[model samples]
Target: MSLTSVEALTQVRARTLALVAHLDDADLERQVDPLMSPLVWDLAHIAAYEDLWLVHRYAGEALLHPDLAARYDAFETPRSVRGEIELLDAPGAREYLRDVRDRTLQAINGRGPDGVLHEMVARHELQHTETMRQAMRLGGLLAPGEPHLDPLTGPDGWLDVPAGAFAMGAPDGAFSYDNERPRHDVEVGAFRIARRPVTNGTWLSFTEGGGYQRREWWSDEGWAWKEDYDITHCPDAEAGHPDAPVCHVSWFEADAFARWSGGRLPTEAEWERAATWSQGTDPLQAVGQVWEWTSSWFGGYPGFVAHPYREYSEVFFGRSYRVLRGGSWATDSRLATTTFRNWDLPQRRQIFAGVRLAADPEVN
Candidate 1:
């Protein structure tokens, strides 16, 4: 039998709690950069979302602890402050996450999955997972250590996929955000995509090679951002490390680099096909390696409809944000679904963002 609702949630919560345990108090509240959040804020935000969705929204119950509501408001959008979010002590926050998860499971058990709250909790967790990954990257938590292929490691070789028509989007029974609605079919010609994302070493080569200085390599808009930001980094403009996933770049930046290298960003169709339609029995599932920026916009699929999470995708459907596929190392493993979509402004890169090359090999 498949895992029960409570069992599934419990397991995921346990894993997330462990991931948070790795950071010290100083790391938890460090926000030296504007693009990243204090890790303490992450903890508080997850608990607050759980309380909002599971307890109040779903069960018609009050918040687990009523006094914490004000703290939630300050966390919705990214902040530039660089100090302790004093309300969220490390030891206390972990205990709160556990209590919230356990009580949510109890509520689910009592309700027998009859209400909408179960699915809401699941979706909320997915968002937190993505945010957590970004925080980890900013904190320098992903320092090279393991053999595991993180977003920062490009595979030594390529993974070639044969041409075929693969079903895309979320199927029924699995709760998906509105953005993943109107499941459709598209043909994907055989193509080779990097098994991992572009690494720091490789990206550094582009910078050292005057990839940024040469207008020939940049698109018109990309050149504008380069000039506007005054990014003359033959040595160090200090955006991020050579080994860290390159964040805070515009689509134009990614596009220019891809073009200079004889490749281009993957279209949304190509990206989803690669991610959701993997070969063999294992379905495409790469949640916490890297957040891949796709050529697709955040617009709805063919037959889109709004859902309860109104702002989830609707607010940023246009060119304001580019589409990002896959979750990053800081992401919660359980929060990701093949159909999940995350987006951010093209120029903002304080997250676990990176790119992998995709192109027509015959032409190359």
Candidate 2:
């Protein structure tokens, strides 16, 4: 049990608790949004998940709440039904967290090489903290971030990533998701990429430029989704944060913006190249503010194999999902590495996501 794990576990708990400190029992139990789970659900889910992995799986012990495991399993209990199900109340949930943490610390001392699993578990809690914040923000329980008094701006010019190949995924040195495994090299062509994610004010330019009305700027499916949802303004733009990165945007919205601006979204490969380039004259700015949508679909790299479990990555490899690069403000630092891949359906926007523009170099 390294001190690092202990610190991470303790620190993340404090952060999660602080995020919900202002909310009462009803706020924690409320569904908030159809797309998000109740805050209480997220709290108990974190504890149950940690106990499953650390206390039972790693420590070779019985689960503290064996009967409750099914209730917290994310896949088994989808977000839509979490609020309707029997779950621990806010007080019980908090008690569950403390009980689970006590056992996890014991596992740290009485254990196998628990560091990797600890990292995975800690990151899981970190991620759900963000998920809880999503619910809080939707329900008006969480306060907005610092206001952007002026329009958002970044480095004045786009970066030129010259054609080259580089290692494109996580290496064996640290803890990474199975999807980021087996680091490999890949080629990318010369392209121009924005130094910062598109801001709320800038995205307004697209919306007011008839981006939604102009069918030419959107794909057939994107257009259908736009029309179906009666979509109009970007969420952050409507929220009065003009200088912040435009958030809560779906992939369809991002692609339409890219097309309207005569630019394109970067493939995950191009995104990684720009983010990881060593001889770079400049680096992308304000990356962690929002999860930048990528043009790439979610899939495995060459010779990709599932580790720990197949459900984490293997089940979602298909065109049904678009890959997102860069981490959002809600993303944990440990899970925000350049190689980390976040994916969702093209039309989903509940998560904190934004866009960065890219384009091919002009052929002369």
Which one wins on TM-score? Answer: 2
Q: What would you estimate as the lDDT of candidate 1?
A: 0.67
lDDT score for residue 299 of model 2 = 96
lDDT of 1 at 98: 74
lDDT of each: 0.67, 0.85
Instruction: Give the range of the ten consecutive residues with the poorest summed lDDT in model 1.
Output: 146-155
Tens-place lDDT per residue, model 2, 122-195, is: 88888888777777767777755522223455565688889999999998878889899789989888998988
Instruction: Let me know the TM-score candidate 2 reaches against the reference structure.
Output: 0.95
Give Cα distance to truth, residue 179, candidate 2, Å.
0.5
How many clashing residue pairs are found in candidate 1? 3
Reference-based lDDT, residue 163, model 2: 98
